[model samples]
Target chain A: MQPVEHPKSLNEVTADKIRNAIVEGELALGAKLSEQRLADLLGVSRSPVRDALAALQAEGLVVISPKRGSFVFTPDSHVVDELCEHRVILETAAVRLGITRNPSELTRQLAASCDAMQSALDAGDPHGYTRADHQFHNAIIESADNRALAKSYVLMISPLKALRTHLFTIMTENTDRSLSEHHLVLNAVRDKDPDRAISLLSAHVGHLAEAFRANLSTSQDGKISPATLEA
Target chain B: MQPVEHPKSLNEVTADKIRNAIVEGELALGAKLSEQRLADLLGVSRSPVRDALAALQAEGLVVISPKRGSFVFTPDSHVVDELCEHRVILETAAVRLGITRNPSELTRQLAASCDAMQSALDAGDPHGYTRADHQFHNAIIESADNRALAKSYVLMISPLKALRTHLFTIMTENTDRSLSEHHLVLNAVRDKDPDRAISLLSAHVGHLAEAFRANLSTSQDGKISPATLEA
Candidate 1:
């Protein structure tokens, strides 16, 4: 968690730190989060910490037991599948909206992001590749020019990041194939073809399904500590 | 705002009240909220109120300015269009998933909810009928058995409710016709026919679009005081 200096707003710092922990998976899903422990960890009062926790709770990333404590939210397979489906819907819509609204500018950005992603792939740096991928999709949403769509994207960011964290660490030969599909998506988006972009995005979503079904139990997203539930 | 009688939990109450205000259009889109006045009006302390404000800030119902207080989220027409389109995606997918997974149960619930909606309409109550309409759709999402979908459904709840509050008041003539569409959708879901359900749901979404297009500026969610911005 990054610390802020110069009279930082307590809740802002607390929310950011907690968001970092969950996004980075330093605090694993379903791990108990004690207010006292967190207060000690962040060297802050519990008041702001509680407020921050409430905010995260609203985001569906944390669950609280009235008398007990808070824990990182642990989602089930059904949850993950539904989220993936939701992503497919939003992403495909973004692609269509992007193409329809601003073809040239979007195509230019897509080409640029593709270049960056390709460079990252060539350098064998998953971090760079992931950053590029994030920017690429974000650009698609921006091009869609729909604040609500972008907000939905923001809502999905945390869980998607969690998924990516687990996914990135488990490298397989599919990495190259995945990049190849990205190329196809880029080509489709560049051509300003909504149908093709949607199909590619569908295949992209289907790939996640394949990954989950092939190794349902092995999803690194599945890491819950019973101790947390009892905490 | 509902007050709690137990330990100090002003944040929860603050969040609920603000959300209601937004949904009711008492807080107009893009209008700034003063925290102190809101605290005074709602008769609570600032800490919990700020916490509530922050939560809504996250929900995209309110926008928080740096060093400034929160403002009502005023979405433009494009955003409205995009959100409705996304609703179509989720509802359609829900139909597809629900019909395949639990056709019998969903069929029964749809029949019940739709019938209830008709009863409410016969009773000449738009509000009751609207609720039945909501439940009929919600039942399908529940049948999908996806917490992610369920969560998205929850998230979508406020916006739809806001839209309904805006459009339903003037949509008396469309009420009976809309309920009939619900019946058609129920028939498809009962038959476990995803395609037919999707078609009906798509048309159902389209009807809302037509209604809104006819009266785009009439806001349903209530407005709040600009003074609510200060804390």
Candidate 2:
């Protein structure tokens, strides 16, 4: 993976590099991650690579088996389904809390995110669009003003993002429709209708759930590796 | 803080000792946790003490300041309110999901836990009662069959248990009421009514929130510390 940004420490830089590589699908599912091989590939020492692997293990993107060493997380269909359901419950709750606490401010932030997403779509920048999409949801979660909610949401979604790396790339059927859904959620929030906002948010996450299910069905061989058992 | 059980590893034993101390009020809020001091207190070495502190930090029971050593978490009134709100949202969602998926089996498990809780109370063993209480809620979360939900719920609630230690000791006035509430929730789940289960679970957690609020109001110094800011 190509290094994009300079982090404060070499360990952090190595970790982010490896994280980006996994999320961008450069590292295939269930692929073995030898510290030496990664160090050689990234032109870094094995110490930093080891630290990076440990960091990835915490983020749920990598798993270590007792005898088999580390591998990229390769969840089975059942895991994916559970992850999707968890996401729906969490994101819906987040949006409802967001609407309840600060309707006008949350609406304004989401509207700005939506505009940025639209611009990215128009510019044919899927990477930019994805970044903005992540920010949009993060803003909604933060707006809830609940540290525990936000922490739990992050812990649950981080692994799902790794699972979605390739699926998101392939599920390019309806950017325009997704953008419109965002606007609808913003409108519901702006109107201070928590019920409507929650319904829209559920449907929005439901769309991702469908895509994850479809991807899982099409890719039958991507079973959970032995390493994931430790996780 | 006395060692009750031998864990599989030294790190685990050290972590459990510190966790128990914090929860049982042997370690006070804002109390500095020097690695050397903890090691000496626990009759262990500094290495394991440091590892234990790191593990406790992950559980939200300990915080490491930039300049100061680790300390027990000291959440103020606002943080307690947010924590209670988060618990209500998550546990209610969990009960609803549990009701939807495996009502009979979940109801059976919760009933068993209620029996265990009653037995503990009859024996005048508050610690045993607390353990059973935790298992009861854990059963509900796991009944949803979502690993991520269970993980998130554990992550969110682990810290709150510290706040409950003292509150639970003093809030003995409603033991019978809480027991009856658990039975009502079990009945609602057995009846396959998600709404009733959610409402009962919400009220059940609401009682804790009320107690926490009352405690915070009476004890003004029990505020979120600078260490918690670092957290």
Candidate 3:
């Protein structure tokens, strides 16, 4: 028999709410998070909000300082580059394992996720598109059927989704290119071409770093200066 | 200048202490943990112990049930297989990145770690050897110079180490083979041969799974039965 699920504690629920807000870009990058404000907004007590922030900090989605207060993570070009490189390593492994162990499932899931992305893009729904995009990549990780790998992916994926949201909304990155890349990778998966799928995925992830670097170099306001990115 | 480090909170310290205890096999696998007893032993209040267990639970080093108390993670054959596969993926990526980005540093750190492991084996210190083994693998991850990847590796390393300790003490798995495998991988790394290093490391990790499976099949007590390995 399937085990019964326990109801999430208030702290867990609060953490999920704040995590979604950050990943969905409702909470702006590097925005200060006031415990009282969050509690008021979420209709919860300060204790749960405080616990949630602490939990989110552990997840790398929030930053807490003793003197300065908590803030959403802000990734600069260097952070973006490292994150992209890490994503490429993980997703490529996921693709290889998925194809080796469960090619049919991976292909089916990718096709479904790809269709969702197309629908979101056609509807001009950035939120929906981003969610679909998240699921599309997650399909590859999930198809590997390794909980350890999936847990690791989940830890890093939020910041990536948040960054994608930032790129989509602020940078206004071309969704059409992303959609096309997804289709190409999906087609390669369908063809059972691990090398082609991995190469395409690597390039696709690399483009985000390139875009971030290009944007950073051209910006005059020093919003995401290289100095801030250090460590 | 390096950023000043903040002192770890009571919860963080408690978590680290408990984590080490588990990883070192001082705390037996599947042994129930009492917050009160832990707090007393650690000379702290129960609150910190409670918080620490929650944190450890998040790290996959501890399991907390609504009815049953927290326990150190106990990996069965299937769990060992999945963990080994996950390690192979992450460490191979680390090997490639280390060879590409920081070969000299990787070689230096690995040689030192290998020497330490050899000394530990010569001295017949299982704990020291396991610690050195941990560092040897960590050197590869650190050389990759990717904090995101390193963080993911840290999350999964504890349970793996605990299993290694178990193998050493209970299963009495041959340490010589593990050491020779480490040296083989190190030699490949020193030669800057990413492909060879990764292949050797993959096989080395795969052996851990094979050992766990072999031991599980021979045990008549059902201590770590396949049923317990499920999720």
Candidate 4:
């Protein structure tokens, strides 16, 4: 794969930037992203930004809520948990093949992600931790070496960044626990132990399921700052 | 639960009809579908038909090929096999719950779909068989009782119908084999055997994968008749 990373046109770049913003929750979930304001922010025309919005909506990252206009598509706790379940299904299948096909490099890559995770945790910034958390799992998905699997994983989980950021805050409070899971997962992958890797991954995704439910149920109780934890 | 099937709007129904036409080869994969012509054929305005086209494009039944305009997305055999692998990931997960919950009515519903499958098989028309195949899997997915699962399943596979239909013509020659496997799958579900159901379902989907691959080789040998077999 050649670096294929560069977009030929500014529209593509703008679309991706907006898409990442939607994913990382620089844009609010269910918030209507004004096209004019976004164009101004991006220093581009409304046409490209609108095109970007259409692209994101097509990806289901944004919902064109009929006459009301386009807003970020927020998955409630139930959908989030379902996505986690979907993750387990696809990722488990991936691990069955991925760990066998490549173990040593997989371990190194995951360990690298762990380094970022630890740094983000120490920084005590929810946003940094959120991205690091994404990269941590991303290493495994990429290791799976199945383009379709990786695409589905990203498409299905892309909308959950908000909820994920919220959960990362809770996990950051017990910082060591988050970093510890990475070590266990990396080791499982390194040992070429599919079952252990899958179990660890499943538990990792499932724990987020339960924790998010708890947060959704009681986020307004005032002990935690919602802004600090916003997905 | 009461009958949960929501009545689709005219545009939605039109989209389904057009999608099937393209997928079943009534409209030929890669054949351009003119909005005005389709609107006249369906006795609807181009506006709704355009909306339908957009919807089908989202579903992937149609490709709005840039500049050249819209055409039915005709996937080759390689894409078919890959798409089947995706279905395996989804259907296997669905059957896990299908057997785990042991819902009695679910059996009867799938039984009805099985009967329809038999009728389609007896019809011996590839197009009819393809329609039946769609219904059969749609029923099985719904039996899984998870909306997110169903949505993900459609999102993953719907656009790839040209490939699936191309695969269907080859697999229909083994209709009895497929039906037998379906019976085993249904039996596993009825037995409240999650493990068995998942295994059988995985193998069933795997059969489709093989069939998809077979279509490619058949095409290379010029054994596939686009007209008669594309029925």
Candidate 5:
């Protein structure tokens, strides 16, 4: 993730800075985050830093221990699975509503995203690719014309972004395959096949779950079932 | 919603108090919420009341309109429709997961809720019925055992609860029908029919959307298409 530039409110900027740090693992998960230290590092007042922590807390990135202090959320495989399941449910519904609402527009946006992914891959810019990737799915959700669905989808995906930040390299490794899958999904939408679109979208997200499970097993030597791995 | 009894922190208490007021429409939608007045009314200092307002704002029940101060969120038909659409998506997914993960327990909870609804109907208690109705759906969500889904569902549903508060009588009118529908969906679940359960859940939430649409047309002369009403 990139650091946000100035000119925005200090509170928002500080929150973004802290969030990026946590996402990039500059702040170790489960490690204490002192407001004084963060404020000093960010060259801001403690009040603004405190506000930033509150914002992060709401996002589930930082947990505040009553007696201790704020800490980056320790990764939980169960939480990741839950998040992936949520994404599958939401994105599948989005595909249904999105294509039904305006198949041509949704297909066009998704095709543009596919092109953007190609450019990012050609340039070897994983960050840019990730942004376009998010934009691609976001366009579908937006086209569904359901604000609540979009909002809930975003909220559920936030922590997963943090998870992605941790396994940034692993996620990047799948980009070429992901790009192809994106096009397949886009083609399904273009063909006006909601069932095919939903199925493809499920498999696409389910692929991420596989990656996550592999990472989890490697990191923790813990087991996860294939049944639980279906996004 | 019933008032949460004491033993909670003042911040939690104040937050619940304000939330109940907003949901009950004791505080009108779009009405300015003065911190001083709220503090005086709740017999607390402004600090806790301010915290409560922040909590309420996050839940979408209250809006802090920049320098204009906090206000009850103005009810919006579009938002209600969006919320209903979200409910349909999440609950249908929940029905699938709940049945797949553990059919018997989920069936037991839904059955209990169905009985609760029946009891409330027989007792002529709308408030109790409303509470049971929420608990019923909540059981479905919780039975999915996905914390992220439940949390996002609650946040998205908050404002709709406020809308329900405004049209409490109208909502209660469909109770008997709703209760019957609940049993129909529960029977599908009990029969181990995920597809049937999902379809019924979709229709059940769709029914609410239709009712809300009719209410919206009556209240604001705002038109929503029946086509957009389906999940």
Candidate 6:
């Protein structure tokens, strides 16, 4: 049996709240983070907020500079490309491992997650769709039953998710295409085609980088600006 | 041009010192870590040591328990298996990326590192040999030029290195075999055969896990004991 998990400390809870804000696009990319403002907003002292920022910095979701203060992470084109390559390497390996180790469970989770994505798309809920999208990939990682891989995935995934949220919400990128890509991957997995599933998943992840690059090129400032993109 | 790197902070320095102790086997695996003891040993205060332990815990080098206190991580068979699998995935991907991106540079560094390992082995210097072994693999990861992949590789490599030190110093596992494996991988990379290089690397990393299991079964206790293994 699995050991009982310890409860999250206040610091962890604060970090999670800030992480969700960033990943869900409630906190804009590259926006300055004021500890005092955050502490006031969260109705806590500055200490927990400080700790939370430090924790988030390690996760690549927040950037803290001693002289310049803290801000949400901003991804350059190079960073986006590298992050996508890293994701493909990890997720493809996870897909192969998942299929080999636990095919039935992996297929079940993928199907369920795909159904959730379909419902979210039908209801036009971007947030729900993104969450289910994460679950679909997460199922593959979890099915691999390698804690180290899952931990590494969690560490690197936040920036990608934050970028996805930005693309979906502010830039209003086409969600239908992403949904269909997920379906293709799911079908391949259910049909026991690991190679096809992996290749389709790679292409699917590559599209996020493409979408980010397209937006970056079209933006007035040649950078991701919430104001310009939303307008 | 690359930006200047910031100097290490006190917390970071403290963490690095402690991390070296663990990774170098100066601090044995599963050894209890008292903040006061460590601070006294390092001639600092307890706060930084506490912070360092937290950081090391994040890297999977140290385990912090609320009730039991902090201890150096001890790997069971399952953890060893999972970690080996994780290493295979990351290193194999790094090998391919390195070969594709900069074959000449990768080949040059691998050859240099192999020479260093050979010299260390000839001199009967286990520590030097281990350091060279690390440099050989690090060359591959660095050659990939993906900061995300390199960061993940750094995080997971410490424990494996520590175990390797244990196998070498305590169990007296044959270094000749490991040296030969590295040579085979280097030759494959030099010959521009990524498939052959990756397969050789996969087998080479798998041997570490096999060595650990071999030692564990021969130990008097079911667990890894420094004294028991030393004898």
Give me the runs in candidate 6 sitting further than 4 Å from their true place.
A1-6, A220-231, B1-6, B220-231
Better of 3 and 4 by lDDT: 3
**lDDT tens readout by residue for model 6, B1-231:** 779878887778889888877766677778888888788877789878887888798889899887678998876778878888999999999999998999999999999999999999889887788889899999999989999999889888888887776555653777889999999999999988999999999999898789877775565222334231110
Best by lDDT: 6
Q: Score residue A87 of candidate 4 by CA lDDT.
A: 75
Cα lDDT tens digits, model 1, B139-170, are 98888887666666677557656655644556
Q: Judged by DockQ cut-offs, is candidate 3 incorrect, acceptable, medium or high?
A: medium
lDDT of 2 by residue, B77-193 (tens): 777777778877777888888888888889889999999999999998887888888889889988988877777777668667877775455554377887898999999999988
Give the count of colliding residue pairs in each prediction.
Answer: 22, 2, 0, 3, 0, 0
Interface root-mean-square deviation, candidate 5:
1.2
- Residue B224, model 5: Cα distance from true site in angstroms: 24
In the range B61-167, model 3's lDDT, one tens digit per residue, is 89987556887776677777777888888899988989999899899999999999999989978778878988999999999898988988888877777776655
**Overall lDDT per candidate, in order of appearance:** 0.74, 0.77, 0.81, 0.69, 0.79, 0.84
DockQ of each model vs. true complex = 0.46, 0.48, 0.63, 0.41, 0.65, 0.72
Off by over 4 Å in 2: A1-15, A35-55, A170-173, A220-231, B1-14, B37-51, B170-173, B220-231
Candidate 5 residue pairs that clash: none
TM-score of chain B of each: 0.83, 0.84, 0.88, 0.77, 0.88, 0.89
The global Cα lDDT (0 to 1) of model 5 is 0.79
Question: Which pairs of residues collide in candidate 6?
Answer: none
Strongest candidate by TM-score: 6
Worst 10 residues of 6 chain B by lDDT: B222-231
Interface RMSD for candidate number 4?
2.6
The CAPRI classification for model 4 reads as acceptable
Candidate 1 C-alpha lDDT tens digits along A128-214: 887887787788878878766677767766676665555445554276777778789889977777999999988987786567545
Worst 10 residues of 4 chain A by lDDT: A222-231
Candidate numbers, best DockQ first, in rank order: 6, 5, 3, 2, 1, 4
